[model samples]
Target: MDDNDEDNERFVRLLRQVFRFLHLVLHVLAGVFLTAILVGLQRRATDPSYRSLKRWWLHRVVKIIGGQVSVYGEPAPVGSLLASNHVSWLDIPLLGGQTELTFLSKSEVKDWPVLGWLAAKSGTLFIERGKRDGAKGASECIAKRLEQQERVLMFPEGTTSDNKNTLPFHARLFAAAVTAQAPIQPVAIHYLNMQGQTHPLVPYLTPQTLMQNLWAILAEPKILIEVHFLASIDSQSVPRKALATYTEQQIRLALRLNSA
Candidate 1:
């Protein structure tokens, strides 16, 4: 390559490295802030103070990550079910940063560090797999939450995947919405890279080492997270199976992600 071309390449590389360094520093500060908020919330779970602090902390985290989340349609009623396709662990704070809905996650997540603690304190529901009655019990619990006018965000894919394709929504969870007569609100989340290109880094994680994966993500400059809320399906109109199928379809269409 010519001298000028080489110089330009070097400059771009330097800029990316500098941005990465800044990103890392910001992440450290955000983590400290999130932890402090979660701990404080834990101490005062019975009062409204915890929710207030959590909202502020989450908003700050969203700003720190340069993540711009846009809600497409009007939010459903307070007791409505907010369902979405699972992309990555980042979906927690990314979505939670927008709204204060409790998440329904796999039981394994309860073993995670600060995240697990925060989720638990925030009243997240953890489902244990490999148990016959687990689904039924969890559904009942979700129904109870809905009846109390609390929003529950569930990923019916049963596992996270690259947002490029949508997974089949687990029909079991929809039963809770059916029993509670709560509407199901579909949402789509997409991640764009620095050049505005779609990158798999959004849902990038593996069974081997989630921590290492998260660290690598922390080292990156930025990832754009989009949360698109779709139309709500009235429980009286759509059956559980139909609700699951329709939601999966709408989410795929909204984000142009595959739902195969």
Candidate 2:
């Protein structure tokens, strides 16, 4: 490459980093300001629910980040359980920005210092893997919530993938939806770049840390996040393992067709 090309590339990288850092500052400031407003709201005789507040804050943050979200399918109503393919940490905001969603995250996330605190405050349920009792308890809690007609999102794959294709789902997580007899809708999330390919910066693959992926997204000038809400499967009719397999296949097919 010529010296001019090298200089241009460096300049672009610098500009991207600067913009990302600015976005981070704005996100944090918005959180603090929202917290203060919430405190005052709590004192009043009547106020909006914390659930609504969270939804609004997340939605506003997505707007501040700037981009067009291409939603292909309709979101199932509030009472249904959302079964989606896991992509990146950004998936939380992208999904939450659309509608009120509470998800079950790994127990490790519950100990990540400030991030842990924020995750818990946002109503994330921490599930400990391999602990039968803990898993049972979580399932019960999820069932209770669904019974109350609250929406819960579960990433049955149990880990993040390349976002190009979906990993097989863990059937255990689908038990609660079955127990509650709630409908399970397979949701697909994709982060696309300017060239119509998977966003180069968004995947949380090996050797790439969470912060790195996040900063990469902030550096990019534009990105498109696609959300597809596939048909809902009736948890009442499908057995646990069948339900899990079907949901996974649905998402995989969605991404495959879109890429084609």
Candidate 3:
């Protein structure tokens, strides 16, 4: 590109940021107000009722950010285990909106100020990776959730990475799927702009500067995230480790994402 192109890009980014900033404020206010109502409603909500409200809230937030989410293939069974590549925190809203699934996240997320509180309120499962017993407990909790016919999203890769690279998946979490005899639906999430450009805005958020993080999201031009739900694999088909590798490859192929 030329200087004019650079300038145009900068202008577009700036416009997006301003809009995002306004949207962010609206979302915060909406979250606070809606959360209070949800808390009250949860008291009288059946399991299915709670999932419906959660899905609606997630969809509204993703829309506010000007992100479009698309999913392929049929939704796996209600309680099927979903294993997907971790790209960014946005995965929360993207995945949350598309499916009525609970997530298994690291223990630290439980301590985050607002985000953490929201995850817990929304039925996220926090796992202590450092303790072996904790993992077992998490697996048990996941199984129970499946028994309730609620899907559970697990990022066996353990952490998020740049949009271009997917990390190796750790198979230990697969134990839960095996125990529950749940079909594992491997999913790939891709972020691209209208021109098929991979914008860093998709996976730029980190733990630092919560304000800046929110700003980065609000400042981006419209983002498009594609979620491909691949074929479901039976956990009992092979060893858990082998299943992990196969699932990883299938998702990478489905999204055309390269791995580090």
The lDDT of each candidate is 0.75, 0.78, 0.80
Itemize residue pairs with steric clashes in candidate 3: 17-219, 20-218
Give the runs in model 2 whose Cα sits over 4 Å from its true position.
36-47, 63-67, 257-260
- Model 1: lDDT equals 0.75
**lDDT by residue for model 3 over 104-158, one digit each (tens)?**
8999988987778777877888999789698789989998888777789998878
Per-residue lDDT of candidate 2, residues 1-260 (tens digit): 99999999879977877876787677766765665566666532113366776777677655555445899888788778999988887778778878778778889998985567557766688888878787788888788878877789988888888877777788877889989999999999988888888876777888888777766766677778889989999999678899988888888888874421
lDDT of 1 at 72: 61
> Which ten residues in a row are the worst by lDDT in model 2?
39-48
Q: Candidates' TM-scores? A: 0.81, 0.88, 0.87
Cα-based RMSD of the predictions, in order?
3.7, 3.1, 2.8
Please report, as a residue range, the 10-residue window in candidate 1 with the lowest summed lDDT: 40-49
**Which prediction has more favorable TM-score, 1 or 2?**
2
lDDT for model 3, please.
0.80
